[model samples]
Target: MRPYRSVLYIPAARERALEKAQTLPVDAIIFDLEDAVAADEKENARVLLARVLGEADYGGRARIVRVNGLDTPWGAEDIAAFRGAKIDALLIPKVGSAADVEAVARLIPDVPLWAMMETPAGMLNAAEIAAHPRLSGMVMGTNDLAKEIGARFRPDRLPMLTGLQLCLLAARAHRRIAIDGVYNAFKDDEGLRAECRQGRDMGFDGKTLIHPAQLAIANEEFAPSDAEVDLARRQIEAFDAARREGQGVAVVDGRIVENLHAATARQIIARAEAIAERAI
Candidate 1:
């Protein structure tokens, strides 16, 4: 029940951003060595990231490193550099199949693996990728997916729904963490809020963010709200009371609280507790 309310990506090449990231109220930091870094600066970024990761103490925030695809010249070296480094997970880019995960897993057998679900093939084969024993999470790369699929920008994300749902379904079915794609317009706080709400409703564990400005909104939207926590507590209490009375169902605010509802309520309470622990 680790709360992944806001996951921010910081370019590995930018030392200042990397340093600033330690203080941000983000649940996880993806040390991006792929899309964010320029081609010429790849090696330098990888070396700098390895050094920073060794020295920096990011507290409870999960430290994940996004390595370039194995097809690229820097990708293999990128994986090799972080083999023994301290990291929560290794994110493999453009992972289309379980075999892709296996290749990286063979190189770094100990660390958990996360896959970037972006390409069309990746969406189609998401179930297999999510089912991989070493895989721990799935990240939606909407920018790449939209570009590859020729999708136009829409507020409701109508065009991207299929791919998003596909990866989400796979992640959920495999019991893996499912993080939604970034909202490109960092300055549009309202738009970011709307999308975050949408993702949270759709069962994504959290949203991946491109900029620090997007962190607060994401953290707010993904975490359990005060009202939600209150409702969860009431529901759990009602359900327990009913069970003690030899009843199978209970009522909470005009809604029935069945066993399934109680289960969900317990999870909500646990998540809220976990978030509180993170704050402390």
Candidate 2:
């Protein structure tokens, strides 16, 4: 799981979701606790999550748990309860600072952490948070971010671009994979696809998804298109041929090509290949 590009959603306390997890064509599955769970059912959700994690084998898919933030009543119990659970990574919610990250890291030293940047405070200290070695990546929580910042949501996301770019920079500075927030419209496939295109162009590894319908689009958008994969293959082949002929750079289809371009092409091909294997 080299930074999943199509992380899936498995509803908290939903046992059928756990069974679906085994067959879903997703790069990763986030067992959620924050938004999908109701207040009265929090304990029940945790217990079910524990059992699902303890017993289910998610094949090669990642199994991440989106635990409540420390400020919430259930947060501490969420952290402590993972003592014997087999979770791959802990998705800490509303992480405000590096110290907050350190606090969770201290409690669970063995598990990798993906901090959510959903508050103004979280965005301000993103650079510091990214510097943590135990930190695997960042997930933008748009709804919480909007609520915290008192900002209005635009369909074009113009108001949030600067903040999104800031988070992207922090992740890039620390060589971390940055994941975009969900589009929030499960019924609007066009809306979701547009957001997915934006996320991909903006350099996010993937977009955090909410519903099952979003999974295929996320996987398809983030992964290279067939044309891109073909071009990448052509670029690699040309580069190899040039290298064998004692050349530093190669020209394929009249376009200048270098090692950097070839490397990028390889990443594109790799994701496409993964999607292909999953399809089978």
Candidate 3:
């Protein structure tokens, strides 16, 4: 899990995105080597990732390389170059089954894999893919998935939740992170914020981002809200007082407080406090 609460994407270009990464407020950076880089620039991108990974500590932000799929020409070299580069995770594109994940795991036994749930096969095999030991999480590539399956986008994403929840359930089953896909409307700040909130409500750890403009909103949406934090603190204090009294549960704001609620409160407080710690 690595204690990540928010992640932002940086396009693959040694010149353009590198300078940007040094300034952004994000928990992790997905240095894009797959879709963002031109075919001709992939080699340069690989070199850039290696150099970036080797040189900088990334300001506490986890560095990830989004490699091309194993079936592509650049994929093999991407893996070969990135394995020893100190990346926190290897983002594998278009993973269909646990076998696909296992194959990559065999190649890089130590690095964790983030499976892309993009195609039909991927959605169908989501559970199996998440079952792999090296599978650290699933990221939805919704644009590609929609194109591949001809799924229409909705105002509320009702059409996509089945696939999205499939990935979420699998990740939860394996105790892995589930991240939402990039919201394509980068220019529309309101839309981006709405999508981020939607993804968070859907139980995603955080949404994948395509632009630096989306960073602040993603971080805001993913972090515990003031109301939530206050509630969590109250729950924790109430439960602690109850435990001191040898009570298993206690009333909190007229609600029946139980251990499950206490556990959630503890997690929320920890995450909120962690976020505050990072800010300091």
Candidate 4:
């Protein structure tokens, strides 16, 4: 959850793609064992994924595995194979409630869990799913959610707004990271930029990307601007000064800056620092 400005998905079945991911600038890499892999390639993909993970040096990128659900024949093997694997978190697909999280949590109690909020049921029980002790973050499965809800894809994402906000609220309420869904038009830079801006405006921590092409845009859009970083520094300084003076609040740029705003500013600075550290 350390400022995942661009979380890229790499098909676990493709060794070349996995090798290529080592050089990408993505904040996180989802070694996909689900949708990206074919049914016939499940076992081989899991084996290859484990080998790559064991042998490769991913630098600062967060390595997360997107495993198939328990309902699938290969799901159990997928989970078992990753029991002691080197990974940041195990992403469980179609997590509808706390029980779904618990089901996988039982297998790998030590590893952090990430849930996919794609179903209507998952949306309704988002708070419960997010409250799980092992749960670290939630990823919006917009494509699956749209298909399940039979909603058409809109450029403005008017249809998915409620679901997106609900998931974000639940994640924030529980102190967990919430990532926005992918922009389907990976080649449409303008559309991707607009969507990344919208996601940032709506309070998403970062975005789940399908292609490497989307990384730069997501990283740029989600990062705080120069003006914002400067304001955050000023707010923190002013707030500290007001506190020393026995004042309850401080004024910054003609607005009342309270401890709450200062707290948010600190987080922004910390996020910026985390991003910088990853780059180094």
Best by lDDT: 1
Instruction: Kindly provide the TM-score of model 4 when superposed on the true structure, using C-alpha atoms.
Output: 0.97
Enumerate clash totals for all models, in the order shown: 0, 0, 0, 0
Best by TM-score: 1
Output the lDDT of residue 50, model 4.
Answer: 96
What is each predicted model's overall lDDT from 0 to 1? Answer: 0.95, 0.85, 0.83, 0.93
The segments of candidate 2 whose C-alpha lies over 4 angstroms from its true place after superposition are: 1-3, 278-280
- Winner on lDDT between 3 and 4 is 4
Total clashing pairs in model 3: 0
For residue 136, model 2's alpha carbon misses the true position, in angstroms, by 0.5
Give the alpha carbon lDDT tens digit for every residue of 117-143 in model 2: 988888888899999999988999888
Better of 1 and 2 by TM-score: 1
Give lDDT for model 3: 0.83
Point out the higher-scoring one by lDDT: 1 or 4.
1
Ranking by TM-score: 1, 4, 3, 2
Q: State every prediction's TM-score relative to the real structure.
A: 0.99, 0.93, 0.94, 0.97
Which tens-of-lDDT digit does each residue in 16-99 have in candidate 1?
A: 999999999999999999999999999999999999999999999999999999999998899999998899999999998999
User: Candidates sorted by lDDT, descending order?
Assistant: 1, 4, 2, 3
Better of 2 and 4 by lDDT: 4
Q: What tens digits encode model 4's per-residue C-alpha lDDT throughout 103-193? A: 9999987789999999999999999999999999999999999998999989999988999999999999999988999998899999999
- Candidate 3 residue-wise lDDT, 110-227, digit = tens: 7888988998899888999999988887888898988887878775877777888899899999998888988888898898888888888888888888777878888888888999
RMSD in Å for all candidates = 0.8, 1.8, 1.6, 1.1
